[model samples]
Target: MRRTFCGSMIALAAMASPLSAESYPDVVSTSHYVPVRDGTRLAMSVYRPAVNTKAIEKPLPVIFVFTPYRGRSKDADGKVTETAMSDNLGLRSLLRAGYVVAVADIRGKGASFGHRRGFQDRTEALDGRDLVEWLAKQPYSDGSVGMVGCSYLGGAAFQVATTAPPSLKAAFIGASDLDKYAFVRNGGITAQFNTRPDEKPEVDLATVPMDEDRDGSMLKAAVAEHAENTPMGPLWYGMPYRDSMSAFTGTKFWEEVGPYTYLDTVKRAGIATYFWGNWRDEPTSQVILSAANLGSRFLAGPGSHCVPPEGFDLPGEIVHFFDHYLKHQDPDYGKLPRATYWVEGLNGTGGYVTSSELPGVRSHPLPWFLSQAGFGAQTSGAQGASTFTVDYDLPPAEYFAFWPRPMTEHGLGFAGGALQHDLKLVGYPVAQLKVSSDNPNADVFVYLDRIRADGTSEVISFGRLKLSHHKLSLAPYETLGLPWHSGFEKDVERPAAGEEVSLSIAMTPVSLVVPAGDRLRFVVAGADPRQRNLTDIKLDPAPRITVVWGGQDGSRVDLPLAN
Candidate 1:
């Protein structure tokens, strides 16, 4: 059986109240076809607070959301409908706070008329700027606009913010990837998930017809144009290196589309941004910390992907953030620190700790050495090594589960003695391994686990690196002293067979607490069965990997531990 832990944030999350019909009233909604600069039309759905079936005419701040997912659509009966609650990007919370909300579709998706030259094309970002300025000019808008979304929609806002639209005063970004190059091809390995393109609807059900497309003629034309839209799946697999160019875009496609490439200009725009992410989500927290100089606020919850933690009102927090930045209202958001991150295995206000500076800076490094006897705080005098054979037929690990089964049990395992006291781990960790492989190139997977007093163990964090792309260097941006691996072609070098190479692999950032009796365990393997070997290399004869440790220059892991 697996154990589950949870922390409560009811008091903090209760700052914003739940929506009530009497307090918020009904919302009046309308559909429109907004035109971009290139004569392409984008679909927008507008919702405003109403009284007695009539929309309020008073100007109010607008909450803007732009996404590739169908923002608005017309049913078979020709009735316009907004996206459902889960996909609306906190529409209810924004509306409950008495603000106008507008959601728009990207150029080539969801009833918008245009063709996508590439994934997250620059053209779509320009369209976002045009739409923001247009929304500010609307009669119901107070000339103030803010963007909100998670995942793809959150990424859209980041791209548009790079354009620096004057009316885009602030934004609420959640679980977004600022660096596409790092996201899709992390550590020089292409993720199987990113290699797949977004699913499309059939011609008859492509998207909803805009308000002006009475006979569905315009909608038909838009669907026809989508046929020429470039598929990102091929481009993802085709561009193996960070600097690889795409013939379709005729540029470094990944860097061009990534918002991180335009950080300087984005800083000049001075958008009061609020980033939200979970430790188990995409490395949005890393992006938030990297941009600490942007004078932004962030919330790093302890959850998976876009899901919020238990008893934490996620929508309520969004409302509080917008109330201060968008409506100029005096909400407690201004009274808090710049960052609030959740510490696992804790409860109440203590779990959600705040700090003026970004996370990872205040912690000290604690080194744990690995040897044939297992893990220990002190290094061993005698030199020794552990070896494991690459299992081509190993079972693939489940990707989306909250707790992974013990796949590393079949691999090389090391364990430390039970902790005498509670151990608190904070920030990023670096695994320094002296490894040698029979094959010229091998993918290394490291798993961090905690062994309970009951003898059961659970995974805490994991990291992977392709040996060929293990070259380290100073990051182009701020990483707060973390190791950076540049996956450029020039930096690529394979280790000679059986040659010992020292690798400092950076694991995922984490905040964890292990009880007094819990022991720390490290598992090292050749490849993760779930992840595809994007290197296009083979291990036909089943290569053996040996991990060298002990003596003066032994293998160890440096963890950031809070004092």
Candidate 2:
């Protein structure tokens, strides 16, 4: 049976700095067509703060966002709203602080002309550069620009920042991936979320027409042109290898489309970059820590994807960041810590921790050895192995969850001793397992869960690896001191039947404080319904997985404990 669950991204203001509705200035918004060098007319919406019902004439720093999701959409009642604009958490806050906000539909998605050649097309980056230069020259703009976005819009910000536009001064990215390939095909397994076959746009959704195009004549034309646009799903599914060439573009699409491939360009530009990420958001938190040494500031929160923890003034942080870089105000700006991450289970729900050095800088590895008597801090001398039959019928723990799935029921579970004191896990956890499978290939999933003294338990973090993609390599970019598997075509090493091999799987990065008397549980599984759907990985005729323990080839997990 199939099931589905839904969750919403939520944020609560830590401090209220409400702009009285009566005293708030009016916002005057207008839409126009900005032509790129390729003559594609990108639809842009410009909003300027007003003084006493009159649009301001003075120049101000512009905050720009380019998104594939409709930039400006109109509802049936003729009510219009900016899509993905709430990523800032406080849009009016930026405007009230003397900043002009601009939102544009990336080519082909909304009321923008031209087909998207590929996912996050390189051409779009050039278009971003052109838009930045154009916005800088606008009468209301102060020749300085900053970009703010989450997810895809964040990708756009990174892509555009790589172009190094002179007018671009700073950027704030949230819940975005550093490696596009790693994100879409995470851990060398295809992600099911963005790779659904031949998806279509929602019927009720409508793009807001540009000024003077109330009849939507131009909007219709733009929609018509979008029919020729390429779908990203097939492209993502087709490219299993990082070096795989896209049949559509006849180029290594992953490299061309990835912002990390051109990370040096962004570093050279020296844009004041700030990233906000969530611990529960797989890969995004990993990316933030990977880029920590790039001279970028980041806030690693203890929330799910795009969700912020309570009592954290996320909007206030954004305002402060922009105020420091864009306005050159705030005397205590540069003194802020380079990295700030939320530690879960602290002070009840959580609290923030700041570090002058990058995350995991002062962390030391705490290795736990696995055995039949459950895991222990000391290594076992006995040779033992556990075997479990693969059950494809069983659903993943927390099946159909929009949040992180729980450990599988059929998984082999081993528990460590109850903690004598509160143990803080602050970074990536690496699982080194020696295993043999009856099948030529198997998918390995490792979950780290916490079992409370009262018997309540929760999954902390999990990781998966397609056995065929287990070969390690030197990473092109920083990997937060975790093991790096290239997932390149050349590195694939599939095990033969009954062959034993060692796999170093890097679990997703997380920050949590396991309280005293709570025991840590490590679960390993050969099958996960969600991951199987993503990769359609084939199982053996009668799959029986064996995990070797004790001695030199024993399975173990190295946890990053903060000093």
Candidate 3:
């Protein structure tokens, strides 16, 4: 027999009035202590309709959510006045349309008791599946469950769905990462900017109790390493990974953790999954790539992080999705379409345009070849068959000497130099370069800029490669029609210390409509200031930088030809 804890009055008071309290089902708050396979205790709170006492009734469908945030209620002063309610008010909207909602803390976070490791997708899936199994046995539960959330929670939802737990039905994963290293690490380079220096105030991992001896040791080591290794190292990677994975501990948790890694799991399980993302997002391309490859239903809209229901009509759409899957009312849900994207720069408001496929929006790859005329004003057309020498033994001054002052002031220079060109770009862009270097091995940095008429320039897109990992992956090509990975760790074949190599670099996607009369400039150099001290570690002895051509044929820039 398992011990179960019911919600206190505080929990009930926290969710007293859902937005649509007057109509539909009445919400009754309840709580429970769900036990993981390892005997670790997890906390869960429920929000469902108050049952009609007069008649015997069947069980109700439940939506189980797992989060690291506390599930306690709040007071008037915003203090912990009561047990937190489920943070997914978006999913609560579904409950108002009549479904039970269950919110739980993973193994070590919130009110749960256990060790918290980082990025443990496997444990989370087991917890999710076990919780569903437990719910099915409950008199009030109809034995059918679905999952929903953004970020880490979204990953957990997908993980649980992949298990094909009999009670698990569908999932809506928002702002998720399918490939751990690619999405967050970016070719072994951590996404330094997205993380805040301070720990999340919502949950305190330091005080969270550990369940096993190994858990305690791992947690202690991770903390010490993070504090010792400041500017760079394995510590940086371990900190974030531990913080995210510590909640769940299992193999399924790790394997199905990334957005890309879990795709096959979901497809094989025949789970109905929907992925959500926003345009202008740092990992926009990654999300698009995942959707295109997985054949999962995707929604890309305008916004930075998660698109709120009010701004992007997400609430209404989510309700429909849940209705179609949970209720089985819409047989055409999965067959409706492959992709639905929101195109920027339409209707004068930069609104959304739906598409059936990722390529429906037509990405024009334009190239702005480098020339010797200096920065943005160089319009010498194609200087085909020209060559430049790159010496890697020099210092930074020779390569980044003229980095514009505006960049330093705005912190853009840290990433790459900005070219003073004025041009409003309306599509994707790529660069092709023919190069010769004094050193056989060298890293190439390319920065794309939009130069204004007033001589001011802003860095728009950038990318990097070691020249050696140029060979594309055939796995994604064979299965999904896309490249899965860029083997950055592989060393480039030596160039005989003074040999030339023709190279083509792919940049991140940019959808800005550069203003007319503005010039588009390409800056190829040996170093990036922002990523300084990060990966692309400062070349100990600097390197020489030079430009060779500027034309459609010769080092060209590809741009999407818009309608």
Q: Candidate 2 residues 1-563, lDDT tens each?
A: 11111112223243223321222245667788999998999998887766654667888888888988787777768786664235344555566556788889888878888888887778888899999999999999999999987777877888899899999999988777777777777667774445544435432138877885768788888877887878777777778899999987788988888777877888788888888777777756445653664668878777776676455777767767777787777667778788888888886677888888666667788998899888767776687999887766655433324244556476888888888888888877889998888875677778898889998888787777877887889988877667778878989988997788888987877688888899988888876666526335546464778889888769999888986
The candidate scoring highest on lDDT is 2
**Model 1 misses residue 360 by how many Å?**
2.5
Q: Total clashes, candidate 2?
A: 0
**For model 1, what is the alpha-carbon lDDT of residue 514?**
75
**Candidate 2 Cα outliers beyond 4 Å, as residue runs:** 1-24, 75-79, 84-87, 196-199, 202-205, 347-349, 394-402, 532-535, 540-542
lDDT per model vs. reference: 0.74, 0.75, 0.52
What tens digits encode model 1's per-residue C-alpha lDDT throughout 422-480? 77887877898888898867778787788989999877777777778778976667667
Order of quality (lDDT):
2, 1, 3
Error of 2 at 210 (Å): 1.6
Once fitted onto the true fold, the runs of candidate 1 whose alpha carbons sit more than 4 angstroms away are 1-23, 73-81, 84-88, 203-206, 215-217, 290-293, 331-333, 347-350, 396-405, 532-538
In order of listing, the candidates' clash counts read 1, 0, 55
Which regions in candidate 3 have their CA more than 4 angstroms from the true location? 1-26, 50-58, 73-89, 193-202, 205-259, 332-338, 359-361, 373-428, 434-460, 477-485, 488-505, 511-536, 543-554
Pairs clashing within candidate 1: 74-208
Collision pairs in model 2:
none
Pick by TM-score: 1 or 3, better one: 1
Question: What is the descending TM-score order?
Answer: 2, 1, 3
